[model samples]
Target: MFLSEPKTLTTSRGTFSYREGGSGAPVVMIHGWPESSYCWEHLGRHLKQGLRVIAPDLRGLGDSERTEGQEHYRKQELAKDVISMLDELGIEKFQLVGHDWGGIVAQEVALAIPDQIRKMVIMNIALINNLKGNMEVIEKVRSGSGKAYWYQHFQQAPGLAEAMIPGAEETWLRFFLQGWSNDIPEDSIAEYVRMYRIPGTPGAGANYYRAFADDAKRWGTLSDHVWKIPSLYIYGNKDRVIIPEYLNHIEDCFEEIRVEEVDAGHFLQEEKPEEVAGHMNGFFETD
Candidate 1:
């Protein structure tokens, strides 16, 4: 098991790191923020039937090379990293799966190269268009249930994020790693903490949050075109960051969309790998 560290690939953009395993139809898995390709390890185990899974750490996060500015971490640019690495690998067509921010980037990839995506699957993430409405809901939650959007508020001051996060990286990660999923492995938490402990990773992770407005505007440029490919949305019923209210109009963005809710929290794949992989496998394998 190449679990200790992932393999690296140098593309035209820069050198990026990824973990690839198994063989057969290509399946690229994109991990979310504060998570490297490591988050997909649990689900990758079940996808060994006939799938070659390649999980990439989005640019600036995980072990990927990072540029100084937060602006370089926008979703469109993140999507470009994935596209470049795949192109370098000579992968012309493949299935796509993303969780958290990766889900949003997957949307960008689907939009950019729709002809190359055989199918798509996303978990616990809102599309760029839905982010504006999501913020509104977050405010209502803040006033009602007091569910704070600390990350958003904190990342609003990127400088502070870089300064403060490093000292308390483990604590911050613990809140999400232990709190978000009921069944995430202890080793997974340790692995993420170890990764974040590397210099600049904390700031790079924050860059993703810092680029929210830029992502929304960048994604806005590719509007009004509906995706015709088959896509599946796997939602975690217990996710605190995103609620059912946010997905009310997701159908408008795609031609064929199916939503499957799992009995878990934000890290649904980590919490329910079998169920998550089952849905993805069934969806991708079917006619």
Candidate 2:
């Protein structure tokens, strides 16, 4: 199967829920929005054979407790939750992996505690600043074109997303799951819908995007900072949400980085778990 049963930790942030299995150097897996730690089930099953795997549902996303206010969902604050969870678990150093918004949080974690992370893998996320020189891509995403990321803009607007997304969560969640992946299993989609249906769950997802301005400001303030950790950048060639073109500026942001392209779409771990886990194992195992 995947791993041991879920465990809960009361951290400085709130009650954090995670799944852990195997033994050895820890590999913390952070899942992105609209999905829970369940997203890592397949990848975790493989990685757990050789490495201790820790996958946590980001605050307010899955079984984790929801903290009130948009500020609680800021990327930096989310990073703190990861750090707090590690503290509670008594883990000192570990490898990190994240997808989508989770990738953004991973970047923040690395920035916050560079020494705590050994190697890192960021999947299907644009970690670089969009305002730097990617105006064309930014405009396309904002205008809802072929590579439209309209949801980012949509979620930033207060009350609108919360009002529209609650009751019709499944329909909205399925649109992204189907549109972003080559063919996600219906059961996976149903599981995500079930989680989002929890009272106040949809709002927590929206809060991640709602904190975009604060995240952007915090990112800009740290623009001169560069990530020193060895990093692997994995992206799917067919990922419409975060197009491969977004990889253009990654080198400028990180000191040591390598790029890999897969044939799947945005939800690469779901569509190509073996490939994703293979890359992670290779990078994390090497010096």
Residue 271 lDDT in model 2? 86
Total backbone collisions for each predicted model: 0, 0
lDDT of 2 at 173: 90
TM-score of 2: 0.92
Error of 2 at 266 (Å): 0.6
Q: Per-residue lDDT for 168-226 in model 1, tens only? A: 87898998877877968887888888888888887788888888878777666645656
RMSD in order of candidates: 2.3, 2.2
Tens digit of per-residue lDDT, candidate 2, span 175-248: 89988887677767887998888878877888999988888777766656677889898888898777655776
